[model samples]
Target: MSKVLQFACHFFAVCVSSNTPTAVYLGIMKHNGVPVDADLMKSRQQEAEQQMQRIRNEIIMLIGDVEIGANCGTKAFEDYLYQTLKLPVMKVTASNKEAADDASMIMLKEWCDANRPELSSLFTLVQECRKWSKIKSTYIDGYLKYLNSATGRIHPDFFALSTETGRMNCKTPKAQNLPRKSNDPIRVRNFIKAPEDHLILSLDFSQIELRVGAFYCRDRTMMETYKNGGDIHAATTSVIFSCTYEEAQDKHRKEYKEQRTIVKNVNFGTFYGLFPKGLQSTLKFKAGVEKSVDECEAIIRNLKSGYSALTTWQEETKRDAAGKMYIETWLGRRRYLSNIRSENWGLKSFAERCALNTPIQVTAADILKLAIVRILEGLPSRPWLKPILQIHDELTFIIPKEKLNEAVIFIRECMEQQPFPEFDLPLVAEASAGESFGNLEELEG
Candidate 1:
């Protein structure tokens, strides 16, 4: 690529990190005459994910189904896919040498050739997919590195105020408001701080979803796993598939999407309702209606057996939510689910989603708020540590090398030991000290 193109691509990646769809849309509109059918075009973006999955399945099925008495041309094709589309998120085929496991290379070439006019768009989309699957975590690392830099100190341009909402807003990279890492880095995160010696202590739960499931469902098994820092997803898998914990763990080994979907089905099913077909789809119901249907029933039966509380909670929550026609955080952050009572089917569905999501999200968000306040007040003894940034569950701080350990312990205490109902559930944390604040992978040893 030309220097200009390279620079523009880099710039575009930065824009994606900002996570503002408007700016992205405007940029696209400026470069191209506003491609029509934007909604359709946007939805077709699903094609990227579906296409990737399809290509992957084709390759996997080929390897599993082919009557390979001898490995011939097929091996070469598998090798090509491995090297070309090195998706870190995906599991690689066992053959590392001159053999390709799947037909991704051919599929990719076909996809690219068929969408030549929109190759740039596809490339952008694919890059984004890879980031979520690959690089976004690194971006988080890099952000932490900057926040921890020796010379780095608090910058005044960090926070802003909205005249419209009369709320404090974050400016610049909007550290306080950086977009969730998705298709692009979105933008630079906005953070505030005292100085290098000062640090921000951040703590979040290791298995919050499990805790939520435990609390909402009153499931002893879920609660106990979280209590002991055991693998909740694997446990769920064990029950749903009627397998041992080891087998459940094996199923999840390289099948994260499948594992995640199944876990989510059971998790959310307790909160809502997981009919068989729905569970199957969540559990990666690919191509086979009968299989998915069968799998879902098994999933439901297992979930009900293990965590019937969730099923009851889901119904109770639904009834409570629907009747209220809205929900609120513990601190009264209300989400008006007017659609729960709406005449429109689409709006009602959206409202129901909001209704279900509102309590869980709002509760978690409030917990974050309470933790922040506690950390700020409790950390005065270690003035070397100052709050630099807050990104959902993660917080950033810049600290002198000497004070980091002490500061971290104190922060963890404040962050993790909030007085929720299940205080003895055993809070688990995964923390790493770092030199700077840019990428998480670069955390201090």
Candidate 2:
């Protein structure tokens, strides 16, 4: 065989052998499809449609009978925002036309909040209309279309090796992409109903990615924060804002709340070698906190200074990837970055960012997969615990209502076990339970 073909075969063999346990676990989850409350789903669909119509009418009244499509993606709507309403365009498609995507809407809303308070109501109506339309069509109608006639549940297919980072991808109804309670105004997750004598329990790894990043970077501040069970975001806020930890933890004060929110976003983005412009845009568009590029640079500088090991690790990682043309997770799963040596600045920079991101993210993915294998091994003793879904770092299951305490302890133990011998920091899995997926309340030990 050609060298390339031989390498490909070896790679596939390694991946298949390493991931067999996770594949088996996912098969079991697929067999036990997620239960749905058909009646509740139908009601939600009707309510969402009504809300969409009301918002559409309100938008039409404001914008003077413009034809607004269900998703507000029409050219006329774009023209209204840029031409008639005169909102500044924040982003554009690859074709270079004025953008009206969700990010654009968020930026336009922020602009209205600052510059045109009188017109803020128009964007609010547009955003709400789009949200209701998505919830209705994507969640309600989408789920109904895929509902199995015989089983009465939506059986989403999971692909274990599809993603480059080793995370499983869900399709058909895309159950993994369901909006969380904070974002789901209509509570679409409530459609994931447990049986009368059962409850939906979720055990989510608490900030698994950050913990993995800390392990990779060996940053003293980050490792110490996790070790002490302190709030990493608050520690980051203290570092960036130059305030006492107590001051940063003061959420009641408006200034501190805004600062902490910005700091949290910065901390999440920093691991991927976030540029100042990117950080500024992320804070404004995603976090709703307007920050100048210079301010963002200062925050990043503070972060690097406070966590000195992070920059050292990032530099060393990039240098190694450039030299070897590949990066690997801590568990030795390799991702080849052919463009690391490219002459083009864009490709080289992207490869560098991937080099920094893949190790930490893929390592976290490995840890989650290991936890799944552990759960699978213990499943025979606890057949009442039916694993239904794996969403990122969280595992959702159905258990008898009477078995809540026992199941929580079992699942938490599975998820919290040391992923590998070298992973010195502690791993935490938080438990929550409820009658429906949307209404879960955190279970205290």
What tens-digit string does per-residue lDDT give for candidate 2 at 263-309?
87888887899899999988876777878899989989998988899
Number of backbone-clashing residue pairs for each candidate, in the order shown = 43, 0
* Model 2, backbone clash pairs (residues 3+ apart or across chains), number: 0
How high is the CA lDDT of each candidate model? Answer: 0.48, 0.88
User: Clashing pairs in model 2?
Assistant: none
User: When superposed on Cα atoms, how far off is each prediction in RMSD?
Assistant: 17.0, 2.7
lDDT of 2: 0.88
Model 1, position 346, has a per-residue lDDT of 64
- Candidate 1 residues lying further than 4 Å off, grouped into runs, are 1-171, 176-202, 250-305, 328-333, 421-424, 438-445
Q: Which lDDT tens digits does candidate 1 get at residues 189-255?
A: 2222223443333444555545644655566777787767788877887777667777776644665
Backbone clashes in model 1: 43
